[model samples]
Target: MQPIDPHSPGVMPSGLHASVVDQMGLAIGAGEWAAGSVMRIEELEERYGVSRSVIREVLRVLASMGMVESRRRVGVQVLPATEWNLYDRQVIRWRLASPGRVAQLRSLTELRTAVEPQAARLAALRAPVADASELMGLAGKLWAAGQDGDTELFLALDIQFHRLVLSSSGNEMFGKLNSLVAEVLTGRTHYSLMPEHPHDEALQLHVDVASAIQRRNPVDAHHSMLAIMERAMTEMSTLWDEAAHK
Candidate 1:
């Protein structure tokens, strides 16, 4: 294996190790790396043109994600799929690259539907006035951006809206669900909205949710979020099933 400086290609060297860890984890989970495979750092170092240090750093990251097992003399060996960390960002990416990933997303969405609507209600009871106002403001941003033929920004703010809502829930565990929430939403953007019609229907629901939360009406917030999730889950399920069959 040839050694090269990871910073030389330097497109995003800070993220390089993470990106490589994600890619390699994806390959392994997608069966390209296969079970029982031994991944020597020398070969990866040569392939990615990153240095041994960068490769080892990436391997250690992957090992932590439960994608690879490493020992001083034994090298890096891919672990069985069952051992992987589902919550690890790279592992989640890798899992989604496999054939049935959309179904996984659907399941996650269903789980979110269960958790987030309740969280919205809980948040309404205690969310700071500023947080409530901010939620309102984000909802407005989402609506205006969607109406302005800016689907990209709309989607970005849309995810942020939910993240903010979760953060307002006053529980660290609820806030930590942001990553899982982001994962589901980011991966399914194309499936959920078209560039041409991105802002059509979501505005009303988001407005309702924002207003309810601001009013500190927990029941109203609950219903508003629940209604939104129900529709989204139904639509997403159909879309995901179709994609799976294709």
Candidate 2:
């Protein structure tokens, strides 16, 4: 069977219920099916040229993501965007694909701002030597990439650097969020929200974070990471504002 294409504009994929799920997810994310909008099974079946069973399964997945609800008399109703599971990776991807994508990116960055500095502090006090060394190496490469105006390399290194910080925090909960952090990094680069040349101060803050972690200075690491995240929030919010008025 052909793999599902999310941008296919409602065309159902061949024999893949996942394709149906993606299409509906994109539609819901894009606001095509606004909150409280109800879709009947028969209508969906005819609309997508799919069987009731396929449509049912697809709707089940969407329901699990808190995107829709099925009632006894009422049909499948679209839930408010706030009801959707933003933490779910697939849901995050769907949101990133929508017109409200920059808003989603900003929201995720806010969450990162809250969590990552603490994770960096924990890593300073607890990460293994190998992880610390690797972080330092990545930080140096990030600096070079920034200086050379190598955006693609800088993006990859930046994601890896933050992912390592989260995973090396010695806190299970923090480690579990590595994927979410990865998505935000990828989203910024993919959407051109990142600056052509990363700021020198930003690059130095990354080095400071790595050095603090290496020296086991939790206080320094925490402050440095906080500065990094605060700068990121400002940069992304500026881009979001620009995009909104355009």
Candidate 3:
């Protein structure tokens, strides 16, 4: 998925409001405005060249996400990372764009590993026939994209494939995590963390998952999905290590 540009047309707050929110969110995530830092409305308005109303709106958005707390005399106090709504899409986007991106990726991947394999297994048992067929089609497209080195197409398809699996798992809670999966997949590609040409093993494992789900083989689906998560962890570790050494 594409990053939500503040200038772009959509559901997000437009123009200056969106820009201010994004900038402030990034700063908070980066620890530029550390927890306990107080941001006065007048100061923020002056800094961003916006009005009091705009600054208050931005603060409201941030406060809803647990990023800040507003008080009468103290202005807006930045909250600790522990207080932030980590699952909020905007929060996830900011964190991914921050300096601590690797840690965010690691945490997201671990969460996926814990949740998706069971989702795949449950999907094998409960997915509708049409959904299973669609997964199979997505898996094939993913293979072609990976083989052709089509990173953009691969990322989109990968997100769709995983999201479908989660939604088809007959569990609403798992379905809600689709956005989290999408953000992490997008972050990986955006940061050049993913290989340009995807691994053949990884491509085949996706196929294995779809095929097993289609065949109603829960065991195979579970194992194949687990393998995919394991492979991702190994790849990320290797890449992080290489980057660190350099």
Q: lDDT per residue, candidate 1, 49-150, as tens digits?
A: 778888887887877878789866877888887787877665666676676576667667788889888889988897999989999999888878877877
Candidates 2 and 3 compared: the better one by lDDT is: 3
TM-score of 3: 0.93
- As for TM-score, the candidate ahead, 2 or 3, is 3
Misplaced by over 4 Å in model 3 are 1-14
Of the pair 1 and 2, which is ahead by TM-score? 2
lDDT of each: 0.78, 0.90, 0.94
Residue by residue across 20-99, what tens digits does model 3's lDDT show? 99999999999899999999888887888776777888899999999999877888899999999999999999999999
Q: What value of lDDT does candidate 2 attain over all alpha carbons?
A: 0.90
Q: Mark the regions of model 1 whose C-alpha exceeds 4 Å error after superposition.
A: 1-16, 42-46, 49-52, 71-75, 190-201, 241-246
lDDT of 2 by residue, 1-246 (tens): 997775475654565787888888998999998999999999898977787778988999999999999987888999998898889888998889899888898889889989999999999999999999999999999999899988788888998999899988999999989889888888888889888789999999999999999999999999999999999989987887897799
Please report the TM-score between candidate 2 and the true structure: 0.89
Off by over 4 Å in 2: 1-15
lDDT of 3: 0.94
What are the clash counts of all predictions, listed in order?
A: 0, 0, 0
Residues forming the 10-long window of minimal summed lDDT in candidate 3: 5-14
